[model samples]
Target: MVVLKKKEMMQCYTFFLLIIVVVASAIPTKADDQKKRVKEKSLSDASHSEDGEHNNDYDHEAFLGKEERQTFDQLSPEESRDRLGKIFEKIDKNSDGFVSEDELKDWIQYVQKRYITTDTERMWKDYDISDTNEITWNAYMKRTYGYGDAGEPKEGDPVYEYRDMITRDKRRWERADGNNDDKLNKEEFSNFLHPEDAEHMREIVVLETLEDIDKDKDGFISVEEYIGDMLSDQKKGEPEPDWVVNERKQFTDYRDKNKDGKMDKHEVMDWIIPTDYDHSSAESKHLIYESDKDKDGRLTKQEILDKHDLFVGSQATDFGEALTRHDEF
Candidate 1:
């Protein structure tokens, strides 16, 4: 047995404490996992920032559809006008020679649908290990979670978060399987992956949001909870970024309408999935507002072509969906 004097023992203890700190620092924190979790925002949230700077890329992507985003960006002014002309014909579905709010809304929805369709096909390749038209829930579970049945790892285990995620995926999968055949077709899988974009899956999206931010499991999100979720990267005693501060204000002032110091299910629904606030509809109005030079309620082909820069990419074209599509516009 080794014996040490008091000072020597203290030095050994200090060395072990330093090693412990290094190991602890190497482990990823809960905040990191929280940040990686689903905080996916809607189109409206993506289009505008906290500082009110309109991100034209998001609007353009929404306007032109994800597939056409790069096509429009790299286009010359003349080329932009040419493509806009073709898209205009599509938007003016009734052959009315004018784009109404409803027509524009329909077009935007179509673009989003196209995005979902394309994205699902790309993602499906990885999950369809059986090389079939549909994916079974068991296959998904095995592929994603490395197990056919997620038998709850103890909470705080490294994989406990994955168990929670698997549970969420299963709930979403069931919702996606409208036919309840225990499998998902492409469309159903699209809805599963992008419940945020689907109308019928609104409740699941809201429920998931509540589950994520409602730390106390009180079925409501308090101000602290909202701020905490947004500031997942923030450490204790660290100062919040300006955007987080602005979001805190937005939550209190605009989000919590009843002023109960917290948000109930209804309030959360309004905040996340407001009945009146349709992303497609809002973008439609905004499109007309920006491009309708005639001051009329509808947009003419000439008007859209004139504002081709607004509708498509003028300056940069290598982001979002553009970079991935290797072929030219």
Candidate 2:
């Protein structure tokens, strides 16, 4: 048995306490680190809460008119086949069995025009309440945000149905108002709605898109940030979901073209907008690829009907709407 005097025991206790303090100071507490991360995320989210508009890289619903969207959804596969056959007939203006590259290009242009015209008319009716063929800032705010006579939204008033839209449109209004007149003519309004149509406006759209996804404010998107934006509901400190894991792999493999472990502006733009190709042309090429059974460069009516499933689903045959509808797209 060993026994120590009081003074000796007191000195030993002090030495033990010093060692405990040193170790405690060396390691960071998990809870503190988590709290700090949460605080940073909260501040970042608050700063960009109003800037919630996102370009749907994979869908086209924004381009479709309401009636067209509904009508397309209601189509059966057989009806889709008939409708597509008619559309092909229209494109095959010469009554030839096959559609040429020029004819396909023209049809693609017409489809683009149809979407723009429909969406423009709908937005015009909503914002141009005075039928003056222009939208003032006041008109835009009142219609979009549901502001009262005082020119501000009431404190207890219900949030606008499209609150994010109000923020996005306001920003666009400022940008599209080239003369800084605080008003938008029909042409300016069209540019705001479809910035991709205006070559100059495309840059703004690309920048905004990048900012929306770049969570850390580092001017680039890491694999984790890319997955986080794509899967917003994913919780911190939880096991990464399969989709997130797969997307991380994809980011490294494809999106991070420079192999830099992060995606820069050019890479992000390529992922989102895909350079050297228009959506309409892409859709046209997809259709031709699916239906051109004889390996010809063009599609024949018989070939399209034979592979009608590729054109129209059994639940909804109106695949044309898929060209502009995000879900089907």
Candidate 3:
């Protein structure tokens, strides 16, 4: 029961979960192509429905990231539209009458950056107890894994996963330590937390990916291992779904380039780090695709104002605020 309770708490606070290894894998078995496909349709950077309905909350998040979305949610419909109109002008980037793709993409990136800043500050307070403007490796480990009477699980304990997670966090933390001092200042801590957002930390992201899906400990991914990762969620007695079967074919036909029958390091890199998928660009294109009237391929101020409800007009979309009011684990 205690283990189950910890698992539940971990899921809720999993945004900074690279350290919580057992609770979350740093990468997916594969980047969820289904969600990626759905993202292209709705303005969602995450997942959505097949029919591409106007997912208001998702669009809001894609345009303004998680934290900003919560802030926007506080606005009344009239106030929301007025504020969105001001934001749209800034997104236009030039004095041009329309918002070009580049302009929209840049704005989305800015919104995401703002969210990352807030997230880093919020989490920084938890680890930087000494207020020395740095989060030491020992400080982080002590705060996260904990100490004293069985606070941390031991080698043979039922929750032994923490041991492996501690090792993994140390590797990542070291990589983020650009100064080589074994301590992460504020900037380094952000890189440590969200490596995906940092260009330099791409290798760490890939290393974590390989460590995650390369489960055979043989240093490569076989087609069976690739398929098996997906089946982690499959029920005990159920037959493999058609999509699962199709994925097996995808591995041989598309994923396993060079006809090697197994994914080498480069192959795994190519598979996960797709070149074409840009979350900001995808959301921008989809937003323009749906809301752009007169088929102009770009949004005019009035066109966006007309579709204000589709963007920030979400009310019941409040996420986890009430839940967060409780004492976190």
Candidate 4:
């Protein structure tokens, strides 16, 4: 009788354990469903659509929509070419007209000046591959565009066709880097500059990016106009004047290892690379890619210093706030 009772107790314990496990497993699924529902609702709110009709806005454009094309018009010819080359190469990974995000990972890294200002920092945050912890090319493009098909509203549109010239220049840049060191030399910069065909291709991409952001039928992107459109969350009453208030908390957290209000741009850039400063000549720790400077196989401290002004210029969109926040960053 004692043995039989012990066996019955064991069975009951096993039954209870099974019930607990089943309940635990179900909670996550339920939570996930709720989270998805919430996300869907948020999208609907952002697009001002009912029944999630607005999600289709992303469907028509590969990277930017009609609303986004206007922003790139202000870029100079060089900036336009570099930026557009990246966009074209993003979608044409195989150097083919069509591509998926997976293939673009092997594409060569494009080196521009390191960002010392907030605008470039923001752009890098949105587009830079290493910072986002995503390795694939599609992920990089998606990070920049936030949607697909800037030219077409749906798949199979000729507007979805990728540019051939941009893809070639991107490939050429990658090929020139040879050793795959992230930075390029004076020779590499010259190669990109001297390419007669690259100029035309850059214009196409730069114009496209500008058109993506250039709203209000204006030829140029004024600070007020650019900031109003990019930063405004129509859902959240009036646009945010600057990103400072929004990122104020996070920036504060990262500021002042030395307890000063200022963050040294180089120090901040280094921190963005690997953990703490690892300045030993080890290849792994070097984060800044100085691809365009003199042929020394390295970017100088002065080059790193210029990033500050670019970032500041990009971020300080309003004159009043620009003046106030000039020294703050």
Q: Which stretches of candidate 1 lie over 4 Å from their true place?
A: 1-41, 70-73, 129-133, 149-161, 179-181, 197-200, 216-218, 234-246, 316-329
Q: Estimate each model's TM-score.
A: 0.73, 0.64, 0.70, 0.20
Most accurate candidate by TM-score: 1
In candidate 4, residue 316 scores what lDDT? Answer: 21
TM-score result, candidate 2: 0.64
Residue-wise lDDT of candidate 2 within 250-293, one digit each (tens)? 67877799999998888866664466545445545656765687
Alpha-carbon error at 62 in model 1, in Å?
1.8
49-138 in candidate 3: lDDT tens per residue?
A: 212333455566667555445544455667666666677777887868788878888977776676567677878876787767887776
Ranking by TM-score: 1, 3, 2, 4
Following a full C-alpha superposition, what root-mean-square deviation does model 2 have from the true structure? 20.1
Q: List candidate 4 segments past 4 Å from native.
A: 1-199, 232-329
Question: Candidate 2: minimum summed lDDT over ten consecutive residues — where?
Answer: 13-22
In candidate 2 the C-alpha lDDT for residue 137 amounts to 81
User: Mind giving the per-residue lDDT tens digits that candidate 4 earns over 243-268?
Assistant: 32433433344423454443343333
Clashes of each: 1, 0, 0, 33
Q: List the residue pairs that clash in candidate 3.
A: none
Per-candidate local distance difference test: 0.63, 0.51, 0.58, 0.28
- For candidate 1, write residues 1-329 as lDDT tens digits: 01111211121111100000011223334433232222333342232432455556556666765555554445455655665677788789899899998999998877666666666777687676676688898777666555565455577655565566656667777888999998988788777777766677767767777887899998999988977765655679988665666667777887789998899877877775567656677778988998888798999999988876666757465323332243423
